[model samples]
Target: MSPFWITAFLDFSADGFDDGLRFWSALTTYDVSPRRGKVGEFATLVPRDGDAFLRVQRLRDGEDRIHLDLHVSDPRSAADRAVGLGATEVADFADDGYVVMRSPGGFELCFVDHPAGVRPAPTAWPGGHSSLADQVCIDIPASSYDSERAFWRDLTGWEQRESSVSPEFSSLVRPEGQPVRLLLQRLGEQSGTVRAHLDWATTDRPAETDRHVAVGATVQEVREHWTVLTDPLGRRYCITDRDPETGVPPKPPTD
Candidate 1:
């Protein structure tokens, strides 16, 4: 198995970079790393107490979206494996140790070569909320749900299972040491495109939502165990009812 360090990225338009950086930093309680890249458009969010697993990019053009970066030991091998699993190559940077591809469902994924390291521990904030940005939920049309799920499972070599809380949700379970998990959510109707949003595992959903709202996010809706909030950049993310320390949903009690 090719070891992977899954990093979630928030890509924003050049015009939205400042606002995006400020909002995400406050929400996640992470400090912005010094800008890098030729145009100073890339940076990582540094956590106070753990390894960082989230980054921000300022795109020259295009709508803001979230994408995953897979840091592996061999970029070519991983990219080839992803291609065999129904992902198409979007760009290649072998010399630079990275390649970009689009998965079967059209979500952007990047494979990069990096040394294997320990997974970052989860972050807990004051007021009983935790921030993991550890899961990316792909919103797909009903027609593409099964195929998309199969594609991700084969691509990442991660276990795929239906969510216990909802039939429409399927989870791509990461390996024991992996930092990120993939979740596929079937929309009620066909959506125009397959897009991804970050999911934060929080111990307290209501308190987390309120914390985000205090930092410029607004509640879009409240579900049974999660609250969806739109960030200052208008991107939607969920504060879920999962343990902050383990990133697991509470287990059902045996009768």
Candidate 2:
């Protein structure tokens, strides 16, 4: 099987598209790519100096959410592999060169035949804060956590590792040069469905949190080394105290 290049996407309702675009662009220091799709519903958030990894879509109907797109040389074969690994074909757009499938945890992913590229290096912001919106954290109910983690690991062929910070947190580690990383988070309690949100690994969490707030994101809650924030369009994301370059959390200070 061919390796897949992952891209994260923010799906917003038509009503929230403008705010989502403005807020995300400001947060990531990205510019909107020329709109595509018949009604101009799809656009990418192009980074200032790196390959683009984020995209936005204005859904004709449905609640706002985050999803992933797998770019491969052959969409049909990739989609077939996904199905073999417990994914269900939600929609087929092979004529258009893409297919939408639902993973076992119920997360939607699109497989496309677009050319793959290396993951762009993360960018630094003003005020000594450096980070990138390079991860999509999938929130899975405790009941489905193990299966979800396995499904993603099989689908992407990415190395799987558990986070030292929390047992419930695991990651489908991206290979070197892949832009987007998938973090599978097991919710403490059972939920009706699996969901996902964006996350940024930042050298300075406080500074990044403040910058996001200044640009229309609201601080929802603060944890030991991470802050949860709600964007202008009410979507949630996190700024964590992790190395932007390596995407690894800093080691705790010695006693």
Candidate 3:
């Protein structure tokens, strides 16, 4: 069965944990929940309007990366299905209600048995602008792209569609009411495991970009509709010109 809720977890090193938390909290205008877990390694960004779908993880080891947590009805069963579809089980924390795994392309994620139904609305700011961190784009190398895409397609049972914006991109259609959507980007020929980055849909891209820059994000590049920036912890994300409420890019002008 497909997950009912999806959360984007931003993993950060021990030394950079607070900085990452502060940066993301400011960006999303969400309150940071008290640290949880045995070693206080996990925290959630609590939205004011609905269930939160963004979290921060303080890593004990490994480089910082973005990962997903699929909230399902049963963690063990979901993990089993994922394994059958080519995911590698990394750890079985069934007692804790989740199982960690890596996809065929080496992107780490977890199947979690957590109930969260209401999706959050966009965060409003001064000057009548709004934004929401709504998508996670998985960067896949060409060598692993096809199989990787198939694995996620089978796992999520979501419609797969090529992106109208670019040939190099395709997306796993988000079910109605899901908090986060998955996007797969086919990268040029390279040798490496897949990685993930977050995306923000904004009503006013220029204003949202400026707000993010005010909070220490450095501009990396500006595309036609999206502006790339590196967070204080140096993770890459984008401010996209998509409707904050619907997460869709605006239609082009007709003559």
Using TM-score as the measure, which candidate wins? 3
Query: Each candidate's lDDT (Cα)?
Result: 0.83, 0.85, 0.92
Least lDDT summed over 10 consecutive residues: which range in candidate 1? 114-123
By lDDT, highest first, what's the ranking? 3, 2, 1
lDDT of 1 by residue, 37-93 (tens): 999999999876656678999999999999888888888888888888888999989
Residue range 1-255, candidate 2, lDDT tens digits: 545578888999999998889888887778899999999999999876756789999999998998888888888889999989999999999889999999887899899877757577777665766788778899999998888898888878788998998887998777788787788899988855788998999887887777888998999999986899998878989988878777778888898
Q: In model 2, how large is the Cα lDDT of residue 130?
A: 79
Measured by TM-score, how close is model 3 to the native structure? 0.98
C-alpha positional error of residue 131 in candidate 1 after TM-score superposition, expressed in Å? 3.8
* lDDT for 234 (candidate 3): 86
Candidate 3 error regions (>4 Å): none
Global CA lDDT computed for model 2? 0.85
Q: For each candidate in turn, give its C-alpha RMSD to the true structure in angstroms.
A: 1.7, 1.3, 0.9
* TM-score, cand. 1 vs. native: 0.94
Off by over 4 Å in 2: none
Q: How do the residues 100-186 of candidate 3 rate in per-residue lDDT, one tens digit apiece? A: 999999999999988899999998898799999999999999889999999999999999999889999999989889989788999
lDDT of 2 at 119: 71
